[model samples]
Target: MTKLKGFGFKRYHLILLGFVTLASIATARIVQLHIYQHEFLSEQGDARSVRNIPISAHRGTITDRNGEPLAVSTPVVTLWANPKVLINQKSRWSELAKVLGESEKSLAERIEKNAQREFMYLERSMTPERGQAAQDLRIPGIHVREDFRRYYPAGEVTAHLVGITDIDEQGREGLELAYNEWLAGVPGKRQVLKNLRGDVIRDVQVLQNAKPGQSLALSIDLRLQYLAHRELRNALQEFKAKAGSLVIVDVKTGEILALVNHPTYNPNNRSTYSAEAIRNRALVDVFEPGSTVKPFTIAAALGTGRWQPQSTVDVGNGVMKVGRYTIRDVSRGGVLDLTNVLKKSSNVGVSKIALDIGAEPIYTMMQQVGFSTDTGLGFPGESLGYFPAYRRWGSAEIAAMSYGYGFSITAVQLAHAYAILGNNGQSSQLTFLQQEKQGPSIPIIEPDISHTVMEMLRSVVEDEGGGGVRARVPGYHVAGKSGTAKKQAASGGYTKDSYRSLFAGVGPVSEPRIAVAVVIDEPREGGFYGGVVAAPVFSRVMAGSLRLLNVRPDNLAQQVVKQGQVVRGGRS
Candidate 1:
């Protein structure tokens, strides 16, 4: 052995000392790593491969009263990319662009533009198969995220009621928007192991479990919805109207059974979307109700104990001067009872009745029947219709208000008013949700007054000379009123040709079950009168709905009599 550093020390001793120092350093490092830094190092390693990713929650399903699905959420996948990493995969750009239905140049530019961003959505709401194809490319930084897409099964038939959702499964309009939070579920998180390529290796642990959204059941009947939709669409086409709305309410439940609008878009088809087409016209569009308010006027007069069903009013030559305006009827009406006034749809008669009853009673009647207020359905963008206060009433204003002019109301509101009459003057809050327990109803008017008004309205539909003869349904008695209001010109006054045809009614007068209101805006073809254009639609829809609801016929004897069959001794 040779001596090196010290004179007394041998070379082997020096070598042994150097070996001991190296072994001691190695031993100290092992102890430090195993005892002190173990937790920190493990965390760092796990951070590289394990990720806490959010789990998409399932959205709720919306069903009609009959349990028919109106809107639903289906599983889908979204493709996102880490722009910083994806920018390097230039060779696979063309394949990615092809799968995304985008130009390769645009895709490249987007990635370059977002170079600083670690994550960006490449494509959202892709079908599972398409997303899997993109994932199969194995391009680094490209990832598939689980998501959901909203589906509307009834398409345009239930579009306005069920509404549509955005690509992210968020409700955008109609009832969907009103109930978004209830329908949107809580997303969860879990730790997952992934490889360097960003493909998930395994689920490490569940941090939180996803909470699925709650299911919603609407009060609508799908069968009646389809029927009303078909009839209103047909009427709009036949009349060449700009737009239309129809609403049906169960008189017993105060639950909206069917609500439909023309010029509506399919919620399922995003390409068919338009601002004008998406409006729920039944609740949003307001219009003067025209002669439809005559029955209410008669009811008001009756409530005053000054007029009876047979009380007569002189509508001389179908025209009368009130303030500065002249009111007229469809024809010369000399003397008319309250029932005949409704049967002939006399504006002058209602105006005389309003003048005699004063503004307070008429205004109170209108206000109590839901005019000038939203129906409390909690629908988004519902209008509070314009109803001038009684204190603001002049003679001219009162006259115009009598015949359903100088004020405005939504179709649903008008339907609700008629429903109040059908419910024997009992008024309840309206709802779109199926009732587990219905709220208590309040009396809007005396039951006798309501009954008298209902009988008068029945004469308007059933009598041969009645204005709403077309609204008659076979084997059932219908109580309703027809209205035609001239639209106000954009400049001033009223337009010469633009008109809104409306028909509001309740069916099976002996046992009222449904109240319906129809409004056709700007009908340029066919007959524009409410009786001609709107009543037929009301007839068809009411007939089909009554049959579909399995309502017993109240006028079967009249139907038999019209069919020339006589019933004797309980035999037909």
Candidate 2:
């Protein structure tokens, strides 16, 4: 057939032409997929198989000065699920419940409750191994997220000082809240690959690196902390007191060696938390100092070169009238030297000294010793104990101020004041951070004056009729004062029965090493005197602390040689 021969094709040629047309169409589709639709398809695939996930940064560890762990962060995982997918896997719900320690019904209810939402936490803070076990079950939509749980190794013993963090690992109190920014590290991001089951197959790449928090080294000595906590707790129980606080400080460095509160709560357990139990009383709560301020009044007099340790004041009938306010003392009316004023805890004696010195010198001396201000700790909720201005002082006000009345002072403030006396009038700012070297100290008073005051304080514990007789250690000479202040009634005047017993002291009187303060609030059993309730705590805690710090004894029993035979008498 020659007709249309130019255009006509044989059967084999037609087949070959058909194959070429199909091949061309296939190549175009390949080009569309590899080039034109490449970006869209890649995005879709990544949506299902890749993800940008956040990596949780580890929280910092908090340790005592001796490197003992106080607070620590442990690695854990939070298990979550896509309820839409999980609800479909009803049969696997029991298995999930078994790992979660929940009943099957409970698991079902949880999943159903969150079914509309794509994400819900099945469990938080599960061990890594436990989380992995659940993840390996191959249940669809189950996911594991990295997290941290804070743990306090010292528990209630260090709770007040170390403080606590919330579920999200944010510091909430004490030193934790004060240095949160320094401790909490920045979280980072990373790209990861996943399979169809939502399980991470491999890490694709690190978009950002996670930064771990820095470790905190506190100034507290764990050993001393335990000792103080135990002694304070025991004192609270023995005295049937409402609450108590104790603080130990290094005289030379002003480092708070130990700070404890009787009503402290455990930082590890959230359920044990309460406002009353969690408050750091040593730094936060303030009370009238009572006889604790007597020494300062005497110190002010000594500064004027008008009084000496032997200077005498007549506390006639143990009562003095100042602007219709009667200042009375429990001691017998008599003439007492400056040293006896403290030893007897005579309110009248200190009042006379305060009246003679006027208000400015007493105010200046107290201010220089760190009263009416924060101890520079920057502790959360720290109180600047109220010390009225000298400009406002009347005769009654001055007399009241002399014996620790009409104002307030925190336990730590009282401790800091005593620490200056112990440190030879060198006032160092208090610190919770361990000091590598002695920080700069302000010279608060002349060395001779401080020395005189320290000796006077020593007599309060060492003399035969000293008020702080119970505070004396067997081998160490303790210099301290006792205070029994009346708590002001809510209406106006002070309550007759309610009292705050206090004892503040420094040890190894010859060369001071440590200063400690103890406060027992409202002792109902035994005596409410500071010498009775707080001084014993000081004695036991100071005695043990001195031995632990290897401080040599300054008041050891006198040894005498008699005919080549050694004889030991009572403590010097």
Candidate 3:
């Protein structure tokens, strides 16, 4: 019995030793994996559950000089889905389509076609209410992402100036497109843990921080914009005109205060968007400026030292022959001084003056005043109106150009030119942004010569039987010119019935605070002359703008008398 017990003990001891050896080897294998190969294991684990997610940044806001919001971004929700997962949730698609305003069949087809795609946009830019309702369904693979949408508070009133953005919140036109880079924000990235259903479980770490877009302040004044829009709309409706545009600028700063177009589209609702409605006509469309160019013509003539504002020109029988074309005046002003020539809008007289000064000087003056060039507003599709090379001009071309016929110019260009004249022949570039410091003005013409032209334009408004008499403001000295040009046909000849009536001028001429330009296209019901169709718009807008700026009235005597009358009536 003693011998058997000892053998058993030895067998048991051998088994125990083998078990101890196996336990040590297993522990050593675990230590090797955890201490030396931990990085590889961790990477594999992360690959299965972690993801890099994009973080969207908010776009910038566009405001006016007064800090009024023009274009703003509002937070919204965008719904997306994994097509492969959504295709299986077919029964829930009808409810999803109803909320998205999409037909069930269409939504089903889109999901089936994009089944291979992990992510697809189910609905973009949904209101918070609609997004919540959609989320209530609790369907798998459906996701809601926070996003932004652009909103224009001023609506169609400032549409053309502020412009619109696309579905992805990208600027498409106007100031929006011009400063897109400055207004677009940069997206960011983050590391996150996702569940088996591809839902974000927890945020792990920030990979990159989002950079929000910077805000932009424009030079547009909301008050002036509304006034200009209202006046232009009224004119279009009253005259039964095809289209019209109005622009107002601050003469001292060279900043565009207001720019409005008729037949404008509501940026918020683009269902009826058309090329005509979307076009910024004041900056893009060019027409023969007619007699509006005559002021510049007279200025060019006076610069030569051979002619003065009082110089006489014989407009014989109100007709001047230039090649095959006959330049005729609206009235028979047989002989008139330079000022009278502009006052009456005498085609023959101005043509004779242009012929005397020669084309090169006129072209040079036009170029100096910023004609035939972009307005420097950096707007998209801006027209650099046609000013042909002086070397290519003939007597007829010069004669036609003298009365504002040969060359073409945009409405803003005409306003800019007049602003230069108003600014004492000092030329500065126009800006869509608020000017912190006034730019140095370059001398374009002699100050005395510009003043002389300004006085002559004032005569056109103040003088009886003048073309721009209707443009006269009650108590202010208004300096401006009128233009009526025949529209050129696409097939190559002038359209007889179609006309572009334009009036460009400066208000409170003694100090010249504001410059306004108005263009009425194809006025059928009312008279098509610039004096009749466009000057009144200029008068109302200029007067209103002058008052809005609180500019000290140059004609305070009239204002005082009017106030005195009110007091006297009260006393009585």
Best by TM-score: 1
Off by over 4 Å in 3: 1-38, 101-103, 556-572
Candidate 3 lDDT for residue 556: 56
How many collisions per candidate? Answer: 1, 0, 0
lDDT of 3 by residue, 229-331 (tens): 9999999999999999898888878999999998899898888578989999988888888888888888899999989877899987987777888777777
Ranking of all candidate structures by their lDDT, best first = 1, 2, 3
Question: Which residue window of length 10 is worst by lDDT in model 3?
Answer: 563-572
Q: Per-residue alpha-carbon lDDT of model 2 for 47-92, expressed as tens digits?
A: 9999999999988899999899999999999999988778889988
**RMSD score of candidate 3 (Å):** 6.1
lDDT of candidates 1 onward, in order: 0.89, 0.87, 0.86
Error of 2 at 190 (Å): 2.5
- Model 1 lDDT tens row, 1-572: 24445555666688899999999999999999989999998899888899999999999999999899998888899999989889999999999999999999999999999999988999898999999999888888899999999988899999988888877778889988999999999999999999875778898999999999999999999999999999999988888999999999988789999999989988878888998998999998889999888888888899998987778999889878877788878777799888888888888888888999899999999999999786889999999889988998999999999999889999999999999999989998899999877678989989988888898888788777788877888899989999999999989899999999999999889989999999999999877889888988998999999999999998876642343442211000
Lowest-lDDT window of 10 residues in candidate 1? 563-572
TM-score of 2: 0.91
Off by over 4 Å in 1: 1-34, 101-103, 559-572
